[model samples]
Target: MITPLIHYIQEHATFPLSETDISLLEEAFIPKKLRKRQFLLQEGEVCKYIAFIVKGATRQYTVDEKGYEHVLNLCIENWWTSDRESFHKETPSIYNIDAWEETELLLLPKANGYYERVNIIPAFNEMRIKLDDNQHMAVQKRLNMAQNYTADYRYEELTKLYPEFLQRFPQHIIASYLGITKETLSRIRHQHLKKAS
Candidate 1:
């Protein structure tokens, strides 16, 4: 069940881990299950856990003053999802995270000393920097698209990059993620299908 976490770590680690290190990792993680529509974190709550999805899907989002949801990220198998600032600083989160499907996760609690253990890994710094860099680049790309691309263009780009997202997530959720109205997303999908057919 924790194979996903192990694989992600191994793939990103700058140096190979020994059996002892593997045992340490296994000891540090706690498995959790979330039913569909269940919230892992809510706005204004301090996020204490960072979860690695072993199965199912989740969405991280925030609601505006007018109560419109704006999705920040989506996670499926092998993805990590968390309210980063809240987790690190023990501050209230602006984001909410919920399971989109019945989800299994390996969670690391902030007070568990997992970070100290992880830091001892030979390539920990390298792995951390790489993950941070990738996330920063992804955020920049999304910001650029939001500023310059039409809803249709952004939807197409998202589909091209994550072909299964359309099928995996509800249209309304996808529309929110793309910062578009559901009606607009429906129109875009209809037009694209018509063109294809």
Candidate 2:
């Protein structure tokens, strides 16, 4: 379970990790498994841990007054999931995070000195910085798309960037993630298929 995370750190880290660094990481991250549809974080709860997905999928979403879920993020293998604001500020989250499939995660909790302990590793520290930068960029890109792009264009961009999502998640979930109605997504898919044909 930790192997994937170790590989992820190695791939993203600016420097190589020493044996002691690996031992520190092993001590910091706790492995957990979630059944499909199990909640990782629920609305109104403070997020306690930042989860790194080793296998399977998860979604972070919010429910409206009418009880319709709007997906804010979809995460799969090698992706990190957390309500960062809730985790950092110790405030309640408006979002709910759940497993879309039986998921394996390495959770880094705030309770212990885990963060400070891991930060001693130069490679882990650099990886954390890189993750923050990439997350910021992704958020900005998603916001720009939501504000300026058409539903068709958003769907196209999803296909280009995360084509696996089309296969892994349901149409309704994909539509919610794209901020479009399922009907509209269906129509767009039909049109794209026609063009491809």
Candidate 3:
């Protein structure tokens, strides 16, 4: 469906799409719905489609040898999610992505023919939008920030970047992303609140 995806493109695309471009997108993208906790991707599966969220949320995570889940990212409406390495390399994914709520998504298949056809449409150049490189850079930037800044600084930066994240995600997951223990995060949050009050 060209519904939410089109709106997302209009909001975020660097270039404008024409009627023919929309038609091409409609033909290429497949729509799907998932119930809460349903997995869009599982560890060890090849990710064939990059999904754009239309509604609800999803989390990408990995379980360690000790079985502790480490959150890599959370995707809400208008966000894109996929294991880029798996998708591009046609290899197994090490991460899992599951719906945090009942979700709607538009899936873009990763095939040369599909890409070629879509690239023929305006504002659809893969070269201009390198998803994998962007994703890697984002993760790297977050890691660098975590290493160099105090927890308070990192938390504030995250809040500025994703305003709804604190309200939407659990504290433990947020703590994990900040590379802190839950108790440490609690102390930081409490201290911040005390100062605000």
Among these predicted structures, which one has the highest lDDT?
A: 2
Kindly list the per-residue Cα lDDT of model 2 for residues 138-157, writing each as its tens digit: 99999999999999999999
List where candidate 3 sits over 4 angstroms from the true fold.
126-137
lDDT of each: 0.88, 0.94, 0.84
On TM-score, the leading prediction is 2
Better of 2 and 3 by lDDT: 2
Among all windows of 10 consecutive residues in model 3, the one with the lowest summed lDDT is 119-128
Model 1 lDDT per residue over 1-197, tens place: 76777677778986887788778778877899999989999999999888889999999999999988999898899888899899989999999999999999988777768867866877644666788899999999999999999998999999899877898899999999898999999999999999999
User: How do the residues 18-123 of candidate 3 rate in per-residue lDDT, one tens digit apiece?
Assistant: 8888888898888999999999999999999888899889999999999988988888987888987898899999999999889999888887566568766556
Worst 10 residues of 2 by lDDT: 111-120
By summed lDDT, the worst window of 10 consecutive residues in model 1 runs over 119-128
Better model by TM-score, 2 or 3? 2
- Work out the TM-score per prediction: 0.95, 0.98, 0.89
Clashing pairs in 1: none
